[model samples]
Target: MTGTCGSCGRDDEDVVLVRRLYVTPEAWDTPGKVEQGDEERWCFVCRTHYPHEELGQA
Candidate 1:
């Protein structure tokens, strides 16, 4: 994946974290539809000078 780095003005694969959501289903072996309400975004260290801005307290 490619993204423009927020800082240093460079284009690279800076984001390292795997962006996804974890959901617990009522049944162990069944697949259920999930409501899209939350999204997790990840960026590289150099990209986010102020990392707190991207990863805020939930």
Candidate 2:
């Protein structure tokens, strides 16, 4: 099964899946290496939707 965005249907907008890339300790310590990855999509609408977080701020 693939991850899907709740609002839209885009693999890139998948709020569930995070395409992570793991590297060894040494590799991680290298000059330039990626430790994490980008997001997978569930919907296309995710591209247009804005993330709303509430921290007592507007």
Candidate 3:
């Protein structure tokens, strides 16, 4: 799918859906499980530049 990358905010055709892993404020102290944040579409360049868990194609 074609869309703006969530990371770099660049328009690209090869955008893909990725699951952003992050620790929530509530879980910061515990740090037991990493929470899955927003699923965003990212371009190939951003996807490579930033490490993220791939959910699938957008």
Q: Candidate order by TM-score, highest to lowest?
A: 3, 1, 2
Tens-place lDDT digits, model 3, residues 1-58: 8888887888755789998776444465664556777888888887777657999974
What candidate 1 gets wrong by more than 4 Å, as runs, is 16-43, 47-49, 55-58
Poorest stretch of ten by lDDT in candidate 2: 49-58
* Tens digit per residue, CA lDDT, model 2, 1-58: 3455544544543354334344444455576444554444333344334342212211
Total backbone clashes of candidate 1, pairs 3 or more residues apart or in separate chains? 0
Candidate 3: give the clashing pairs: none
TM-score of each: 0.27, 0.23, 0.63
Please, what are the lDDT tens digits per residue for candidate 1 over residues 1-58? 4654434345665543332333445687877544432334345655244322334312
The per-model lDDT (C-alpha) reads 0.43, 0.40, 0.77
Candidate that scores best on TM-score: 3
Better of 2 and 3 by lDDT: 3
